[model samples]
Target: MNRSGKAVIVLLILLAAASISLSGVIYYNLEKEKSQTNNLSVEISDIESEKARLEEKIDEQKTELSKVYARLEQNEKKFKKLTFSIDEEKRKSQEVVSESASLRKDLADTKTAKVDLERKITQNQEELDSFKLEIAQLKKVKDVLQAKLKELTGDFDVELGKIVIGPEDASSKSSPRIDATKKKSAASNLEGKILVVNKEYDFAVINLGARDGVSVGDMLSIYHKGNYVGDIVIERVDEMMSSANFLSSNTKEKVKEGDKVVYRSS
Candidate 1:
């Protein structure tokens, strides 16, 4: 019960209270650290799950990318084929244009040739007409010459016949009765041979002449090989030969050289 004894008891009581407070503080700190560690573990597990989901998304994107690349390759092949077809069509078009040009040139040449042919034909026709005109003019001149020659030849043949027949008296030449009698005598038994025949002019020449009683306007019969050929009329007379033109009515055959010529009464 003294002051020292009481102070010692109080001090012991204070120490006991302090030790209890420290033990309580240490237990509370240990419990807080255990709770914090459990929260850290939960956070790590959630982060790992999020990483696995992101990887799966990346794999899906890669598969889609491969399909897109395949489709792009197919489109490129189609483009190449289209380009080739377009080039082929262009070549064919060029060939057609060239052919058209050639055809046009040929057509123009053909037209030119046709025109030239027509011009030549026209020139030839003009020349032919000119030749025909010249022929007609020659025919007219020949007819005039033939008529003049016939008149002169008749007079010469008469004089020659008088001289060869021993000369006629002047009164006998003037007498119509004497002339008629002479003509009647000349009509009998007159025969001769054809010296020449001209089929183009339908005329013949005979050996019989004025001296043989052949005169202009006398009718004669023609014969070949005993067959009657044709009839001819004396056109011109000479001393030794006479020219006669054929008659169309009874000309059964063409007169030939050496054919027989005989006088016939009208």
Candidate 2:
């Protein structure tokens, strides 16, 4: 309780006050740190929940991706099969095209052969018709010759007793006798015009016939403007028309329609 004791007491009172203030500050700082630690813990918990949700969504996406990959593999297999089928179709189409071309060529060849065969048949038919016509004409000539032979035999029977055999008479009997028709045709002065001239067939149709003193095998001269063009031998005769064949040796020019034909003896 003297002066020095009073000073130490005052210093102890200040120290005590400072210690009280520092304790209060430390308590306030520890409470603030505790509040901050609780807030951080709550934030960490929320982060963990969000991370779990994201992981689950990622699993779903992986499953969907696997399904997509499976579908893509199936489509690739189908495309490969379709490509092989398309190649086969193209090859078959080419083969069909080649076969069709070959068939068309064969058909064309067959058509050509058929045309040639038809032409040959037509030619043969024309020749056969000509032969039939010649046979008919020969039959008529035979009838006429048979009738003349009958008449001559009847005449020979009537003159057989009066006939005498002599050397000069024997020669005369052996000589060939001329038909009356030939003699008449040779002396005939019949004149007529040609109606048709077929140069390809080498024949002519004349206006003269049997009625005009024209007979079969009678030679006639064809004249154009008083000049001899050719000669024709009568082959077939009608009442007003006659068909004659051209004499190749006597043809000086091509005969034409309306040319004059005069009978002449050969």
Candidate 3:
């Protein structure tokens, strides 16, 4: 072959080798670039996931904040209600204090009224005692007047066929004695003197009986020395004497030897 043709062939071989080398280098560079692109895509996905999580946490915080605000509003309303209740309680306490003071005044008034009633009762008791004393004095005066009238007009002894001597000496008189010599007759005065008394047997004998209009169940008021003594009821009787039992004992001294006796009226 010719020399120029050999040189051309050699040049072509060199160019082909250069082309293959360049293509291998370019392929290696392209593979490395592809690997970097894949890594970048993975990093982008991780970043997106982190951003979504952060947004969810923000929403949760917002929800918690709303709940807190609601609770705060409820606490404020409760505080206001408590203040109103305190004011109402204070007003009721004032009313209760006023009522208590009024009740205390009423109690004091009642105590005063009770003391006044006791004083009035004591005064009334004193008046009753005075009346009893006055009655006793009046009875004594009446007895004295009657005795004076009997002395002035001796008809009481002559008409009745009895004497007006003292009770101690009247028994010795012949007419007053219950003997066979005396005559039984209806008595006008219906009066008597105690002749005998049996305190152990609770009985007494008077100088008046059937003839003196004395009957069973007749009450007699007895006196000793012008002092009121007691009462007695006639239980038995004879022609000139009546037997009686004491119905009541009033004086400290029991019925005695010369006690004056008179018929009692209701």
Candidate 4:
């Protein structure tokens, strides 16, 4: 009971102390490992969430890029169409300009032609006026020459004697006796009368006839109370009557049934 019991009690106390120390060290290590594991799990979860967000962003960027590409293609097409329309419009404008130039040239040519034609017409009109004046002068000269011939021919005296005395003066009882020399003198100085004026036939009937020397183609004059009325040509003749046609006349002065007939001495 003495030494061996004391030694056994000491050994028991030492074993209990050793056991308590080992348990405390083991519990502290376990708590530290658990904390490290929780931290690692939280970090992994955060990395997974960040990776999903990055993938969604990448998809959205791809969609936007696709829209941009489509817009660029549409713009290119619009540009090409606009270029074609501009070229067509330019071609049409050039054509219009060319047509306008051609029309202007034609208008200028027409104006020049009109001016030339007007000038020619004026010159022609002047020439025609000159011709008319020349004709008038020639007519006056002809009339003068005709008057001179009538005076020289002595034809008017022969017509005068026939008009004054009726034809057949050689055998009529009522006929006046006329000497040959006196008859010649009377032929030079006789005036006459118109027995009938036939307007429908444009002729005058006179008492003078063939026997008194009246013949066809003889010219006679008509008068009304000493005023000259007209001129006539003998168309027909008989022994006691003759008819003459009015050659040139103005009938403003009336030639009635009893108007006087005469012969102009040139």
lDDT tens per residue, model 1, 1-266? 99866665555555445445544543453354344445544554554455455445545555554554555455455555545655667665766656545545554554555455455545545554544444444343334334434544554454444432212232233211237567558655877888666554567777776556677998988889888887899999864567888888347246667889888755
Q: Give the alpha carbon lDDT tens digit for every residue of 1-266 in model 3.
A: 79866655555555445545544544553454345445645554554555455455546555554654555455555545645665667665666656545545554554555555455545545554554444444343334334434443453334333222233432332322354323222343355667666544567777676646777887888888887788888899753467788875443247885688887756
Off by over 4 Å in 3: 87-266
lDDT per residue, candidate 4, 64-170, as tens digits?
55655555455556556645665677665766656545555555554555555455545545554554444444343334334433442343344333432222332
Best by lDDT: 2
Indicate the worst ten consecutive residues by lDDT in candidate 1.
164-173
Q: What is the lDDT ranking, best to worst? A: 2, 1, 3, 4
Candidates by TM-score, descending order: 1, 2, 3, 4
Winner on TM-score (2 vs 3): 2
Query: Quick one: RMSD of model 2?
Result: 71.3
- Per-candidate RMSD vs. true structure? 77.4, 71.3, 71.3, 76.2
Superposed by TM-score, candidate 1 places the C-alpha of residue 196 at a distance from the truth, in angstroms, of 1.0
Roughly what TM-score does model 1 have, to 2 decimal places? 0.34
Cα TM-score of candidate 2: 0.32
Runs with alpha carbons beyond 4 Å of true place in candidate 4? 87-266
lDDT of 3 at 112: 57
User: What is the clash count of model 2?
Assistant: 0
